[model samples]
Target: MRDEWNAPWGSIPELVRWAAVRYADTEAVVDCGGRVRVTYAGLGARVERAAAACLAQGVRPGDRVGIWAPNSLDWITAALGAVSAGAVLVPLNTRFKGAEAADVLRRSGARLLFVTGTFLGTSYVASLRRAAGEGDAAGPLPGLPALRAAVVLSEDAPRSFLTWKDFLASGEGVAAEVVRSVRVPGTAASDIVFTSGTTGRPKGALITHAQSLRAYDTWAELAGLRRGDRYLIVNPFFHTFGYKAGVLACLTRGATMIPQPVFGAETALANVAAERVTVLPGPPTLFESLLDHPARRDHDLSSLRLVVTGAAVVPLSLVERLRADLGVETVLTAYGLSEASGFVTMCRRGDPPEVVAATSGRAIPGVEVRVVSPDGTGLPPGSPGEVLVRGFNVMRGYYEDPAATAEVLAPDGWLRTGDVGVLDAAGNLRITDRLKDMYIVGGFNAYPAEIERLLAAHPDVAEVAVVGVPDPRLGETGKAYVVRRPGSSLTADDLIAWSRREMANFKVPRWVEFVPDLPRNATGKVVKGDLREASGP
Candidate 1:
């Protein structure tokens, strides 16, 4: 058999096929939520069945199939199955409320949706029904005319939805050979990951199958992932890093996947000890929580060996603590965004402690990284400027949004990352600031404009400006300065409580200050730099 790195599979389907035969008996995924374990062979069969089911639902190639749920065994099967059947995967954020998810679904024109029953006390199906209201025509959710079916990944479902068992059984009629006949090419768009940029509206970045395979294959090799190494993936699958680095990387390396739907420090410790989880990738807050948890000494976490963290600032102290306290063999930091296929500069395995803690390492092979000034001139080493990347892994473009795509992608093929950074003498990339007012909240990207737009929906909120404030535990959290409407007796606590219901938990501001008016410039644009300074720690 060809080595995963030397002769990588072209498409996800080809990779799945190869791994199923090569690692048939190897433990593939361990879903703690349902206490299920499947081998690579089992996963492959399940994916084929899932593909057949999609075909049974009349899903055609290039059709958009969206999965709006948390991490689980069923999620993998369905997502991979949809892709194997020639559909472009669209993973919605599990943290999204009903309205937030519907907006993306409408924009993408998704045909089939696989939604969870109820997650974290809220019934997703009910929330979706409320958000969609009554449709003027047919389909599971009338508000989404393009959506042909909605499958609930649970035993029971609402009136018009299909249960997990029923959905799988529908495809039993199709022969396996028929499913194998449809081979997806490497150039076909694999997934469209939607990210909120400066516009505050989420745009889908179209990434091809080749880009996904090549990037994560490199990610697996760089991280030293190998056969039998169990990985505990806490990152949400909706994001590119979570799906590409967590799932796809494991497949290439024959590693076992342990999906954590939600992150709780205690639960994670238990899983690490119980499952002998060797690889753990998440935001720095996750490590901080594990390190500080009072019950740390109670668990047998000796099996924990590798950790990969980034997105926000990485402190030297945190790096030392992981190696010293937990006896973790390797702890590395890296940086990437959805636009770059979530694979960029990452510290090598044997790098010194100082380098790993300080900078996101040199660019990956076949990719070029350059820092440039506002005048489009290349900046010298140590000068912080806009980071530009020209890479095979860079996304094709935003799906069908040519004007928006043209803004960031230059004609010369250099992708303007909009992130301010400096390249040291050794080419290590250290991100200093953002051209766009975006922040990282426990690994989730939080854009100020997106938060402002959501906050504006409040009836009493006259105006609001959000800035990222440092949190010791969470890398950074949002703090909002608001101007309440006249005669509105809106309290900070009141707005905070209301925000919990309206937006994702990470996007919700941790602190709210009432202001007379927002600080604005001559052009009337909100001067967020001033707000960020005023909200300083």
Candidate 2:
């Protein structure tokens, strides 16, 4: 018999429209700052206005619009606005530097950018200016020649860029009321999420609206989301877990979202009780911190009915503590990547505590997962191999990078997740390690190649290699082994300081070791595995 839950949903916009009608008077989005709340009607109105503003800025169908901002009501508004304007939304990590941000903007050919003035202690306007300056110098940003304007989310805009209010004013009042004349459906490349590649560069994984919607639809079912349920969103909106699982799921299910710009353990716990948040999903680190917070016992988190965690390997002890202390009955463990548009495997709400705590759970209905050996042969149960995924939720491909796309997407449409895992006889997936030289620190994927590339760019560094070292707080932190140029005396502190200025905080190597030469194999390739072992516990 066919599963009733596996039925296909047509499009994403349908869900948006559904929420507009069903929860018109319900509080849809609540910004913690000043307790700003937007009803479904207000959200729909703002999305249309933002869409019209984007169109006024010359964004046409299929044009990419980059959103480099943190978690906020406006960030979600701009995303829906871009979609309504028939533009593909490109969400850039707010932690990215000007150069890294420029690479994605240039590659996506984003004509317009929507960014916040200040987010998580960084000035986006300043970063945009830095990126724009690179464009003036005929750099990578020049590839996005269509990029002429930036819309900043602030009352007082930057010197040259347009303010969010002013941009909305430019659109005709009725323009926001306009609805799509065409019925779009199922995997039409709605957004592009950039994931760090093993080759040091980033890959823009093109996810259609349908794929994202499918993720939310399936996840909502798994999590038991429903109308009036409130969700505390601490995950960054730029990540798929936040956008698809947290925001979109809430929107589609007529649930309310309590938006938190930054993740602080105390703030999250307080918000959960204050907002009556029923659903909470974040990285394991987030939950651990909240559980370990000195003031956790003082807060009333009893309202939390469900908590989902992913993006890193969660220790079983942490899972047990969540259930014992936090009273979270439906604790789920899920696994997915940007390429899968969020979740391919997940533990259902009613799953046994041990199943939820110890395993990544079964594949979501409609998603097929396989464990394959190096020779492309399928591995049996309990055999570890590179995890391959095929599903409706799989990304279309890397935007404008066919060669790179081909390397990951097999002709049969399976996406090589580069994650090493084994499937038990019960079909639960257990991730062992990454096949690619990438490490997860606090849920952020950091590629050794990327850090090594940045380190090699330093004038004092002749050769460099990076490996992950175990860390109690971050799970895994980068440890760099560098060979300085002859007569160049750079201390470990110097390298750490330099990295802080050059890369994102999470990507920076926590410890730097100076060495004459890196361990190499017979073929002269740096043995990163050996380095990891040498830097062991």
Candidate with the greatest lDDT versus the true structure: 1
TM-score of decoy 2: 0.95
lDDT of 2 by residue, 412-452 (tens): 99999999999999899989888788898898889998889
Give the Å error, residue 504, model 2.
1.0
Please, what are the lDDT tens digits per residue for candidate 1 over residues 1-537?
A: 122234558899889889999999999999965389999999999999999999999888899999998988889999999999999999999999999998889899999999999999989989888888643337888888899888999999978888999999999998989888987999999999999889898999999999899888888888899999999988888887678899999999899999999999999999998899999998888999999999999999899889999988888999999999999999999988888998889999899999999999989877899999999999999999999999888889998899899999998899999999999999999999999879999889999889999999999999999999998778889999999999999998999999999998999999999999999999999998888878954
lDDT of 2 at 126: 76
C-alpha lDDT of candidate 1 relative to the true structure:
0.91
Give the winner by TM-score. Answer: 1
At residue 365, candidate 2 shows an lDDT of: 84
Candidate no. 1 TM-score: 0.97
Q: What's the lDDT for all of these models? A: 0.91, 0.82
